[model samples]
Target: MIVARELPVHPQASFFGAGPYPARRAAIAAAAVLAGFVLTAIWSAPFVDSVIGDSVANGLLGYDAKATPIGGVLAGTLFAFVSGLAGSFTACNIAAFGAVAPLVGGQAGEKRRFATTLKPLGWIAAGMLTVSVVYGVIVALVGTRMPQFSTAQTTRLSPRSVQSMIAFGVVGLVFLLLGLIALGLLRGPGFLRRHPAAPLVLMGALIGGFLIGRPYPLFRIMFRSAAEQHNVLYGAAAFALQSVGNIVVMAVLFLILTHATGGRVQRWLAAKPARIATVTGAALLVGGTFTLLYWDVRVLGRLGIIWFPMISW
Candidate 1:
């Protein structure tokens, strides 16, 4: 018989010491997912021409190989981050439930109720991730289509369009007001203790309202000019700028919602909101900066602002 000697555990290796390991693991997983997304976006460029050849030839959309190579890349990166974060949050919640389920079930009915509430959140996150990925793939495959632009596009503002914009603006203001009200409700004494989920529910409602009310008619107006100019770089830059704007507006609204709901939202909301904000902000800032740098160079080219070396990277 062979004798086996067990290794002694380190004295410092307590449960508290091990607590941050899961967080570190989650961060690493998120980073890896982000990297994979970027790589996949780069790989999808070759198929763009073949996938949308008919649309391009039919004058429905425009495509330039050299100028817009980065469009798919940017879209892919955004979609990947969104989907990855959603997945990470869902996984973290599921893990939390697994650990707490036994204790909660043994004691008061808190565990069951908590798990029941969490299930829908997880499902919604999953669904959103799926939709984001599908949209990303479609965008990548078809490339972005240029909207038809005419003189009507430039100068014509219809009465119905004006009325619609006014209506949307009014609706958005109402939601904004409601969000503020919810915030006030949250700040009352014992509000956090009594109604933990109220802030999240209110925030979601506000964000949904904003998305529904916002108009992106600019894309339609600029489509023809962008395509006729064969300015893939300009198109990509504009798309990136628009996406950044959307993300910025969403982030500001998110922050406002959280602030209104009290200083801190729920654990689940708190965890991913910071990460999403950080990633989205970083991407937008970097993309916008680069786009502006290039735009300045082009303007200099056109206006004779400065004569310098035409450095192509």
Candidate 2:
């Protein structure tokens, strides 16, 4: 019989003092958290483009993308928030969850209600919420200011429009490729394999980057349409609400981990990497396929070979 070898522990991997320089490791985690926000802010512009471009490149609602400003913004935020809940269970987020689970969940081995862990909970949740809100705002600010164009405008198959279609297709493939990584079918570069330690900025950035670039259907659906409209308020509001939802859901997970001691939840999370990868992978694959085929459907509609009813938002 073949025996499976256990993975050796890295000094940097231990959250508690079992490893050498435990204090420094904790400090590094804290620093990474803060650094995550800085990176998210710095990369906001390009991130926005990548996200919004994915939407625009896919078919958008045209004039309806701007339909009712007030209602749209409110609805967009609400919907995005709901969507974020589902989107949170990915590798990047799982890393974030694991990173802070020890601190927030505490050293207590007893499993208790989440209310008991409110002290550490407050700080961690607040910071996460704040960073997420900032990320949403940045995306909105950039998305609204981007050049005006729409799927409706691309009905004509001119050279410039053809080029645009090609770009969108390329991005769709990129999303698909990323989905493969999320699903564990592909490995990331070795350096990125390290679990983000604190000041948690890098962890936050990873979450932000994953959320922004993961080709989640909700993001592509909500932001893409909003980006085409150039509605700053809607864009910002939508992202803010989405972030709020994500933070709340993730906070609940943290609380569960902290209070439900004995590390049952954490261990379960760690043990099931294949399942997590599969779920996230499937979602991205479907989303990427939809994004890529958007133009093809639009072209077919333009040719009047197959007519489909427009979605009422």
Candidate 3:
């Protein structure tokens, strides 16, 4: 008979195992997320101003700013999806994703690793979606009660179409420039190339805050439509749908980039990070240019200039 030897297991090796260190880490992550939410709350009131501005602009243009249930949901879903995709490609997320990829894809086999990678990502997505929707609801409730924002009067909100148009044009230009930077066609900040080892929980909170933060001009525009309605539940539902759309896209990205079979692709992407960034940037540039052109045509038409085939979609 032969004696068999067993390998020794370290207590700190597994996060799920019983240990004070793992518990402490978990507590820290939770505290970090809560802190992020509190910071967002502090900025909520200022964001309401943007909401009012957007609503006034739409009303001046003879567009109904009040959001219907179905329309709000649809609009939220589309815009948030785009926002989430763009956010994921940002420096913070890219760094987090790169740091976690190896662990996600390092399981015993290809099939197992892919499945394992999705589990944590799904959890993070759910957490982000839940937190963001809660924040949206809070904004809707607080903004609706404010005296100035209670009514949807275009005159009260300000009927300056020129200013609004200029603002949109500027926004378009900024996105276009950022996109160019991503593509490497234009020089970008060097910090983007660095990968930081941030905790997953902290990253989740950051993502949640980004998607729902009222200070972000783009989100303020999207929220303004819902805010004009002054219905808390409706606004929350709209934002929830938006978060769902964002989460879905994030899941797909996780599936592709961190799967076990994606090692070769990952290596290729790593070797040409600038090239990948460039492609993403170009897409943003095209989108921004289109938006500017659309608005320019609309403004010119309003001024009695003849323009063929007005684009309203």
Candidate 4:
């Protein structure tokens, strides 16, 4: 009689036991994102406004620019915490999808297929999240202190204000250019044909530059007319709400993109030989353009070269 021998378990089979069910993981990530949103709203509504008001008043009345810096630091810390929570939520979602892709796509016949996809997604999410949190914190710290740097009277457009606008406009142009370059690079032959990474990188750069530079002019214009506007508090709250809302919107968009791409992502990943050079080069170029725009605007404003147009409601 011939003895029957058990076959060795496949590596792909291990995935079924390695992580939590995909649905559960996705739900947990969603919950974390929601919780973070709630916490951010609470802190931003009253606490942040009060801090800003105090900081502004102290700086203006005592000519103590340091008060603004203190306020900025506090705001930055809060934003950093919120950004961290958002990053965690995003990461968990990416992991869940990665863990489930093989099962969902029915690719379990291939060894280590799921792990292969998940690893890169996990690393990319972690790196992007770290960068976002750091960026958010820096923005918050500097933003709160901005009002203190102005001249005593609000209505008159100071020479410094003009300088700021010119600087900001130049920076915006630079980011726009970089975004265009990224688009061109992505259209070139290579992994760009399959990966969405290039587009994402371009979007991030444009968004970052707009966030940092665009706001300065608008804020300056608003500051001048704030006395006539009774809704300064509301404006502050709206800004905070918008910031958190944008994150939620992006997460939803990512979900949609994932669903839309479906099995194509897996196929592309399996076929490509990890084109790191292409992805990294495109990302760095786009990111650097945004950074340049951000700093240039502030330097220009300080030099009194441009003035932001006031918005009338």
Best by TM-score: 2
How do the residues 174-251 of candidate 1 rate in per-residue lDDT, one tens digit apiece? 322322222221122345235434323332232222221122232222332234334445444433333333233233
Displacement of the residue 176 alpha carbon in candidate 2, Å: 23
Query: What is candidate 3's lDDT per residue for 40-64, written digit by digit as tens?
Result: 2232322333354345434443444
Across residues 195-260, which tens digit of lDDT does each residue of candidate 2 receive? 323323333433443344334445556666566546666665666555555455566666655455
Model 3 RMSD vs true structure: 15.6
List TM-score per model, in order: 0.24, 0.41, 0.40, 0.30
Name model 3 segments beyond 4 Å from true. Answer: 1-73, 86-114, 144-202, 212-214, 244-250, 260-313
TM-score of 2: 0.41
By TM-score, the better pick of 1 and 3 is: 3
lDDT winner between candidates 2 and 4:
2
* Top model number, lDDT: 2
Better of 1 and 2 by lDDT: 2
Better of 1 and 3 by lDDT: 3
- TM-score attained by model 3: 0.40
**Two-way lDDT contest, 3 vs 4, winner:** 3
Kindly indicate the candidate among 2 and 3 with the higher TM-score. Answer: 2
Model-by-model lDDT, in order? 0.29, 0.43, 0.42, 0.33
